[model samples]
Target: MKKLLFTSLLLVSSTEAFAKDITVTLEVPSMDCATCPITVEKALERVKGVKEVDVTFENKLAVVIFDDEVTSPDALTKATENAGFPSRIKS
Candidate 1:
């Protein structure tokens, strides 16, 4: 009975879907004034599977959460750069 229960639990747990750890925090060198967040948010929003985006003008940082299955951190960075702002991954 224990073996059966364990097997069932394993299968159920394995079948459940979970969010991936695909968060990226980066600094935008070109972000100087107020409109920076708007630009960053709009650029990131166009990407598929991007669930959240937070941009800090004061700190010049952008943190994004995206689905790995749909997009990648590299792609996210590229998108930000293309939006007329240069960015680097925060260490």
Candidate 2:
């Protein structure tokens, strides 16, 4: 019984550690036109581990959900930057 309990706890802990997801909003002030949002979304999607991307052109904000274990907020920002739309985390 003790062995089974220990194994179960280890499995649960490892699963939790491996499945971390993070969401962040970034302010993109450089988007000049309506089509910029599509460009921004494609850039972010190319980044590894990026699960979802939503860009609001009027608000000039990007909301992204990614796997924390595979990517960071910095990487997300860099992706946008590489696409010619530099951004920063929204306060």
Candidate 3:
């Protein structure tokens, strides 16, 4: 029973790790002020599966790691818009 439980746990963790981390650079045209990135970062943090998020205020970019099963880039973009920083995926 212990072996079976350990195997199950290992499989689950491996599956979670297999989920690819996608990074997106966003064109935040509305980020005209210094505080915009802070708000955007905070808003993105509210999303369900974002493992990490880094915003570049000067370059207008955000690199994010998220679980594909739990969220998507389109959803992230929408969240950015709702946060008052309208953004579009780069490439």
Q: Which candidate is the best by TM-score?
A: 2
C-alpha TM-score for every candidate: 0.76, 0.83, 0.82
The sequence of per-residue lDDT tens digits that candidate 2 reaches over residues 1-91 is 9999999999999988888889999999999999999999999999999999999999999999999988999999999999999999998
Query: Which digits, one per residue and each the tens of the lDDT, describe model 3 over residues 1-91?
Result: 9999999999999997878777666777787777788998988878888989898778878777887878898989999999888888888
**Which candidate order results from sorting by lDDT in descending order?**
2, 1, 3
- List clashing residue pairs in candidate 3: none
Ranking by TM-score: 2, 3, 1
Task: Tell me the lDDT of model 3 at 13.
Answer: 98
lDDT of 1 at 57: 91
Residue 84 CA error for candidate 3 (Å)? 1.1
- In model 1, which residue pairs have backbone atoms overlapping below 3 Å? none
RMSD of each: 4.3, 2.9, 2.0
TM-score, candidate 3, is 0.82
Residue by residue across 11-63, what tens digits does model 1's lDDT show? 87875555464888988889878988799889988989899999989988899
After superposition, candidate 3 runs with Cα above 4 Å error: 6-10
Candidates 2 and 3 compared by lDDT, better number: 2
Query: Which regions in candidate 1 have their CA more than 4 angstroms from the true location?
Result: 1-21
Q: In model 1, which range of ten residues has the least summed lDDT?
A: 12-21
**Which lDDT value does model 3 have at 24?**
68
